[model samples]
Target: MNHALQLPRLEKTIPLSVVPSRLAAANAAVARFLIQAGAVREGDIPQAWDDALQVCERALDAWVKRELGALHCFRPYFSLAAVDEAGGYPSASCKEPVRYHKVDICWGECREQQWAVGDALEALERQQAGCGAAVLDVLREKSRFVYPLFTPDLACDVVSYVYWCGEENEEVALDMECGDNEDEREAMREEMVTRKKLDESFPAWVIATPRKRRLSRRALARLAQDASDPLARDIAADVLALATLRIEDEFRPDVDGEYIGFGAVLSWREDDLTVRIYDDLLQMAHQSEFCDRMGELEIAIDAPQAMRGWQSAMRVRFKTIRLLDRLIDRLSAGN
Candidate 1:
């Protein structure tokens, strides 16, 4: 007699449940197993995960559109003055003095839930298969459903997809834009020049940022160990997996002296450590010890008091802050 609990495969044709997300489908399978085993009851999936998924879906929908595909919106840093002069300012609060964009991509949040889902899936799969248990044999076929989601390959794939999406969007935006008059045409030409410069600046900002000076493998190891929250520690590993980065500085030609933009470009690294997730940038970014040190470096890139002249150095500093902010925000959210 077969005693193992048989579970239903995810339905692939229903309108509401047909296209289950990778994380969601994996999580739902695990959640069902736990319920069957009396490990946990229904209504346990936190509302926060629901909220984060909603936001991620919206961003995905925006990027999927042909017209919007060329517009890079992931943690974008742009000069408010320049946008306003071009009649593209989305809001007044999105104005100057904010060097880094204050938007949330929900990456950390979604990732945390996915990791939790992965842990649950692994545990449940082990139990169901009777691995390390007294049972001699069982169906091993179901084990493959517990795929490793947190590996470097998956991480790099997702990040690359995001970058490609941005590039596609930017290309479409540039090609579709047209000027109505000579003055408008001149403005368009200048904007195009500025955009191109910003594009070139991304890679330099990633490699040359002052944050690279303070970062070390050993330091990340210690920070991960010392972090109070488990999620914070896991996020540390996520940031470390990022192999490359790019930042661009944005300025306002109309305002003459306004420095109001920055951007992020990222890819995966394939070194020895890339195969093994280890480094932690969030804890280091949040450390008070490095804050003043990085602050001093920031002054060198900026004009000491004013917010203009955000060179490559400044772009690096701001991106670090943005990553730190993202981690902190994710850690603070309800589970």
Candidate 2:
């Protein structure tokens, strides 16, 4: 048996019926599993416990990042101010902020459901093949069916995120989008984004089945051909297997129609052992923490002659507060 359970979501520790998702498909799968299992509990998939509110808030923050993606939709069309200029294309004065352009794309809300955990498990063990087929149906259509229903006129919402979907959806992205800059001016982007200045480089990424995205035969040959560090490259290939799950989470398609998705919990079927590639980023962010915090720190060496130290500290503090304030504003707008 190919282990009827699909995705790495079925860890060796989990039952064959348990299907976890780090993509939109999985969210639908989770929902369908609950329905079939008769474990439907009326609530959110991101079901936050009273004690877990803080953790939920942090996780939500990390997951709701693509709201500005709609802003890019505006780029194919208007200026930031023009969207709010009262009479710009799509009549920027409308109340909804996310504008719909390019008839090919749209977004919608993810529904709330009660997952009956016990029932789902029973169904999985007993229903067998039926359970697998049910989950797949939910995965492909539930969200896409509702995507075109939302109004796209949020002028102010341009900079905000849509929290309804998983971080799915694959359109080519600029390598220069280092996740820090918010300005969308074309002229300035050219000046600020040249080919990477740092030696570090991220590959051009896509969201898809791991089998398709895994280090390819051609990629292996290329890695072998390049001699700088063959062992390191081999190691990198292994590390990338885990990293690909994170990438899939980032680019998974919108099942709920919203730009950002209800984050997924994913796993994989590696030979001999089943594994998960990505988990919640907030909990695991420390894995990516820099080895050298000292590299960026500066020594006063000789104190600046023209600078009044307290005023400079105050200015730095002022900018920090503003940054946080903008962030909070962005979060509130989405919810």
Model 1 scores worst on lDDT over the 10 consecutive residues at: 134-143
Using lDDT as the measure, which candidate wins?
1
RMSD in Å for model 2: 28.9
At residue 265, give the lDDT of candidate 2: 13
Q: What is candidate 1's lDDT per residue for 51-146, written digit by digit as tens?
A: 223333333333223212222122322111111123342332333331221111111111221111223222322433211111000101111111
Stretches off by above 4 angstroms in model 1 are 1-61, 64-215, 225-228, 238-255, 260-326, 331-335
Clashes of each: 7, 30
Cα deviation of 117, candidate 2, in Å: 4.5
Q: For candidate 2, report its TM-score.
A: 0.17
